[model samples]
Target: MATCEADCDAAPVPLKIMPKDYVYSLLEDPQRILSPPTAVGETLGIRGSFEYFHYGCDGHQDAGWGCGYRTLQSAISWIIRRRDSSSVSVKDQHVPSIREIQQILVNIGDKGAGFEGSRDWIGTLEEFYVIDVLYQLPCRILHVKELGSAEALAQIRSYFEEYQGFIAVGGISDTASKAIIGYHCSAETGRVYLLIVDPHFASVPSCRQQLIDEGYVRWVPVDEFPAGTYNLCLILQP
Candidate 1:
């Protein structure tokens, strides 16, 4: 009864939609939500299912500094779902919240003190550490200084085909975080396309279609991508 009483007095953990609960969650399939408006090439996308996470989740105010965390949550959500596809129950496979992620870094010595409670931003490297420490999962990072690299694009397409999972992308000029769930290359015009699910949306629209109608979830050509060093975090599954 003492343990029960303590549990009752402790704060309640916010209920997060598990990977298997997409049926009950909002529309999150950005890749298939709306077809590309212009004529693009054949699209190759994630093999397994995943979810989209954005700002204001659990009532946390992380607008400017939480994009990477939200992107990481989406990417990690895919891995958890894939790993637990055969399992009977996935109630314990919780995606770490922003505060939990911050605390984990501090606890594991990955981040120094004063980082747990701060609203500091994180990048792809921090994402790698968090995924490694949390799930012991290995990740392949493609470090390139530009998005127009021919070899990098080839390898990224191959990654989607091989691993068939979501990729966390960072290093755009504005330093926003996004997920690359699908890729396309135009054979006629020799143009490159990417299906990006941005995590910087502060207010999730009341309707799922609004998210797509807006620029939050859409196809962007490589030429339109901001100029900066590009890094990709590819989570590999066994």
Candidate 2:
């Protein structure tokens, strides 16, 4: 595992283009609603990833419009660490910087008309651009329209069982999005909480540590998930 550093030292890895066989799977309320695992201090996350804040830049200042890139970068960094850690030392890992993220947006081809790369908007499809264009991994997009709390938790647990991690967007508000890199289940209350890397925060080098100190990843009730309508991006390796 790469040790946490002042710079979130996750070295960049060669972008692996996902094979054509790897495509996004859309599911609307999968019928499997099995009981979750014993909620005894269970938790999951990208081993060496850190929290990131999206702000400071002109167009990226708004939490609503900027969360798309922030959330996508969060997932990309996690995947990079998961893929590149084995070859580098704790100090040598390449963490994706804000500049890299903007470049990625530019490289994805179309940013839409009147697109100044700033104040532009993107949704689940744009999220796919980062996943499909920026990395080599098979991903599944779960279009959760009205999924029950129990069913959603079961599906999330099932995905973690099969993939490294997943990204969830929408459902919180009109435009709130975050990366679901980890989860925790409490045995005492039998409540399940997802450990997420929320992208809404003031831009600062201490953002990651601030999140950790604030217990941002604390277990949050799965049933109370904010998004009434959400998309779960199931990221997997080919």
For this target, which candidate reaches the highest TM-score against the unseen true structure?
A: 1
Candidate 1 lDDT (Cα, 0 to 1): 0.73
How do the residues 179-224 of candidate 1 rate in per-residue lDDT, one tens digit apiece?
Answer: 8887788867878888889987777556557778778888788888
**Evaluated with lDDT, which candidate comes out highest?**
1
Q: What TM-score would candidate 2 get against the native?
A: 0.65
By summed lDDT, which 10 consecutive residues of candidate 2 come out lowest? 1-10
* Runs of candidate 2 exceeding 4 Å displacement: 1-39, 57-64, 85-111, 146-148, 172-174, 205-209, 212-216
Which pairs of residues collide in candidate 1?
none
The whole-model C-alpha lDDT of candidate 2 against the native structure comes to 0.52
Quickly count the clashes in candidate 1.
0
Candidate 1 residue 156 Cα shift, in angstroms, is 0.8
Badly placed stretches (over 4 Å) of model 1 are 1-26, 36-40, 88-91
Clashes of each: 0, 10
